[model samples]
Target: MSVLPLIFTSGWASGINAYAVVLLFGVFGATGLTDEVPEALQRPDVLIAAGVLFLCEAVADKIPYVDSLWDSVHTVIRPVAGAVVGALLAGQSGSVPELAAGAVGGSTALVSHLVKAGTRMAINTSPEPFSNVIMSTTEDLGVAGIITFAIFHPVGAAVVAGTLLVLGTVTALFLVSRIRAFLRRRAQRRAERRAGQAVGPPV
Candidate 1:
């Protein structure tokens, strides 16, 4: 079995939550659930760092606008994490070239990240904050479930991940109009605030 499938699955998961993927890989490797995980990822320091970051993300991801800000920050981090993880997996398995795996992982992660960020932007347009929390929880659960499944059945998990990536992309596209409306409303609000600020305080 090629490690590419697992790499693809991890990349997809990483876009949503890189820290969780790292933490899960470390735990699984340390516990001997999977030997495919590299020793570097299993180190205690790595696990701790990943754990802390995951917790931070868990909290920040539930907030309405905060999650979008978090996603913007991770725009670079997620793809880089995906590439590194893919290279490590490929190096361990010796089944795929490191560069090839890295390219696949990084590209997939970038696409998935864009989809997630766009969807979150659309969700943020909602007046209620519950949507953000619900979406965040769903993404977290989905990543965990898919990653765990990938450990046991890489190909199947890859298929599932790919399907999700496609669906997410489609959904984001469908929500383009809403996103535009949100942007316009936000801009109008900002302009209004600016105009109010420019006006001198009431005499």
Candidate 2:
């Protein structure tokens, strides 16, 4: 019954979509739906801002290259958000140091962010945009499900989320070579197209 599970799960979720994580905690905390959230996040302004940002991210995360761009921009933001959320969660119990929670959250977020960014880099190489859309939707839903579960069944949620995070990072690392090969192939194709254009018609 330690709150570590909820904190860890939230930190992991924040890495994927910090705004959604913030919005979830804020709304749920404000509504008294769950006692696990911190009062600091229950403020009206925090909830509104998080909700707006979540909307913005929802749109940006569906595009092809745009999603990658968004991820790059959030390289710092997401991890920081994760740390902040973790610190807040820890403050509720008074048994843990907020700094310690922040460190855990930040580190977990960084790992998850790398996996997400690397996967998006690979996915961007695809010609069709459908895969990007599907992946984005899947991530959003995954975050949502994890947060909701953490509310009522924190330990179970933490286990499941941690498993996925580890799996994703490992898979992304394994696919690095494949991703590099894909980029090389794409560059070659582009070069061939340019060469063809330079040579002009056979005449």
lDDT of each: 0.95, 0.89
Identify the runs in model 1 with alpha carbons over 4 angstroms from their true place: 181-203
Which candidate has the highest lDDT of all?
Answer: 1
Screening candidate 1 with a backbone cut-off below 3 angstroms (N, C-alpha, C), the clashing residue pairs are none
The TM-scores of all predictions, comma-separated, are 0.90, 0.89
Report the CA-based lDDT of candidate 1 relative to the real structure.
0.95
> How accurate locally is residue 50 in candidate 1, as Cα lDDT from 0 to 100?
98
In the range 1-203, model 1's lDDT, one tens digit per residue, is 79999999999999999999999999999999999999999999999999999999999999999999999999999999999999999999999999999998898999999999999988887899999999999999999999999999999999999999999999998897777887899999999999999996898
Question: Once superposed on the true structure, which residue ranges of model 2 sit more than 4 Å away at CA?
Answer: 185-203
